[model samples]
Target: MHRRTFLKSSAAGALVMATTSWPLGARTRDRIRVAMIGTGLRGQSQLGPLLSRDDVELVAICDTQQVMLDKTLAIIEKTGRRKPKVYGGNGDVRAWKALLAQKGIDAVFIVTPWEWHASMSIAAMQAGIAVGCEVVAGITLQDHWDVLRAQQRTGTPYMLLENVCYRRDVLAVLQMVRAGLFGELVHMQAGYQHDLRAVKFNSGNPNEPYGSGAEFGDKGFSEAQWRTQHSIDRNGELYPSHGIGPCAMYANIHRGNRFTHINAFASKARGLHEYIVEHPKGGANHPNAGVKFKLGDVVTTTLRCENGETILLQHDTSLPRPYSLGFRVQGTDGLWMDVNKSIHVEGKSPAHKWEQAQKYYDEYDHPLWRNYAAKAAGAGHGGMDWFVIHAFIEALKANTPMPIDIYDAVAWSAITPLSEQSIAEDYKTLAFPDFTEGKWKDRKPIFALDGRY
Candidate 1:
């Protein structure tokens, strides 16, 4: 969609949604009336915590697929809570606008596909509703800037729900970094290196096990319905927030530091095609086997920060491999590598020897984890999901700033389009846009600093 047309439609939608006047600075309400857009697997995960909370009320839900809506409704029914108004049961893509137009919604969780994130967020914000959006804030560089401008124009809250930043070990590492265990931060490495072939292609049948077939688009299940198309359309770091979010906090991006420039390189595309050709449901004769995917099997990117720190991020999801973020935190004094689960400190450790990371994790365990471990137990992604949701809810309740605010959101998400541009130009270095508009020098790091949700 054209930028002007998107902005115009978003404004019109917001006007329709804002039937009642809401004070620009309004924060706390008796109960934060919450609506959800896109009740897929990710949306349901957020729904569970919202249902469990006393201060939140599920006001509405929207989705293009009845199957997903029905499954979500079933989950809500089991909780015995009041049923929310439903929208988008019959493949109406614009049902979310109707949900937004309803009265008395203070916040909205936008757990939709990557492409819809920017527009939905802009509309929600324009309607004076706080937005808690899923990763990769937008698909294109322009989308990132547009989202940023919308948040600035409207004084509404916007938070990126990047759960990996709250992972137990990552939090422990954050604590260690603050304590100067990893002194004089210099360089770090992280990546989304996972085998997502199964996730990218699956049978449409709900009864069959997920990832059982190599059919995507309308014939695919869950993410395969839309996520695989990106492989055929683009070549770059398709998903970078999972790896960059935590690393950004450690390096203080947009908080007295910022990424100055970046360059990326992409390996040949072979994994997805190979997976489809070899699958039992799809042979060499299958129509999908003839498709050419543009996404590289592995894309590597290097980012230079203004504070003289450097970061390396890798996006590898098409091939067969074990799941790992491949995080490495290195500084002048010591370093830690998640792949080996090992840490080395200059003076604390015996000469050039590596110590198991568990001891350090236990020693410098973040206070947030220590305080909320019981509450977070059984939540998604090793209890990190609970923390991210907690942060959003608590921030809204307390009328405070989000842990991951608009600037951080755009900076992390812009990696995707910037990397694409870099690779297209034969690995040319590109200046990272300053989404903060020169205010990053004064911004302070407040994410999980005191362990107070």
Candidate 2:
């Protein structure tokens, strides 16, 4: 079916969803009342795109910090949008629960720290609210299961908010794969290769609210800047979604294929420790300055897919390095690499040479991009965020399955903890938790060039 026809049908299907009274987003008028939790950097970035929409109403904004709550409310008001109900998560742990209990909200976006994902998401679904959560679903193996079980029990659909999957170039390559431009997929490589040294160390910048001490607590850092704290405690791939999300989509993970096992190797932790030791800010006598960080600057994880394909994942955020997700999809016929933005067709290309991938983009940009690439969706991360939020709202209004559902969320995010375990055991091959319990074998792909998402 054509992309437009599929979207129209999906829109029609969304209407059928409105008949149900128990579900939150399944309202008859197709107007979605939304709530945003953690209105810091990530959450604040989402406001422009969300506020621009006529069908979406920002009914509430929740954050543990008073600054974020009041700031976001003012921003929403400036848009002439309704002043969203504010929920301060400061000292009270259940502040958001009260907001979720308030009858009006249809969906909640959990953009908080790594730890709260499962609990908040499970709670929101139980409260009859749909969810759009940020990456790295949960912090533990059990956390992953709870997220899946809660959504399943509540019969609520969720979007993982993996924006990289919808990136224009990423989508273009996906289109090529769907069109058989790359034949018989074999191996792929992706990674988090950005240097976040300054970000990890500059924890208390007074000018920027995110950099302020409120993110982790009054302990000189707030949970919003929790990545640094996470590094001090863990040793393996602390965050893997930026690299894994796109590769998972290309590999068709949790749809027809799943990661069978993981073997991880880590270089000794050096970045954060060295930064503290060298900097004058955190006196050398300070406990944190003298502490040893367990997380390695570089971690390499290899995943074996059930279909005999291999994925090479690199976790390299701590050290000095230029940013590169290293998105490379290779097959029997050709290969495409994101860092270089180039592809080579096996027999059709000049002998063993890399050609400009720009040549193929016009012909192969995905159907989704063909429709909305030029139109600004008022979102960040190179306009992909708009598409993801668009998909989430559309799914909510239409009452369809999210493009990146609970299974995908768990399967992709579980890598961090699983990699930690593998590295702890001297790089032993660890089996992955089958969150789907083998249902991937028969599940049809929810995301497609058909544009149903």
Q: After superposition, how far is residue 66 of candidate 1 from its true place, in Å?
A: 0.6
- Which window of ten consecutive residues has the lowest lDDT sum in model 1? 16-25
Candidate 1 structure quality by residue, lDDT tens digits, 124-206: 88888889999979998999998998887776789999999999999999989988998999999999999999889888876
TM per candidate: 0.96, 0.90
Give the candidate number with the greatest lDDT.
Answer: 1
- The parts of candidate 1 lying over 4 Å away from their true place are 1-6, 9-30
lDDT of all predictions, in order shown?
Answer: 0.89, 0.78
TM-score, cand. 1: 0.96
Candidate 2 has which clashing residue pairs, if any?
A: 14-398, 215-222, 215-223, 216-221, 216-222, 216-223
Q: CA shift at 398, candidate 2, in angstroms?
A: 1.1
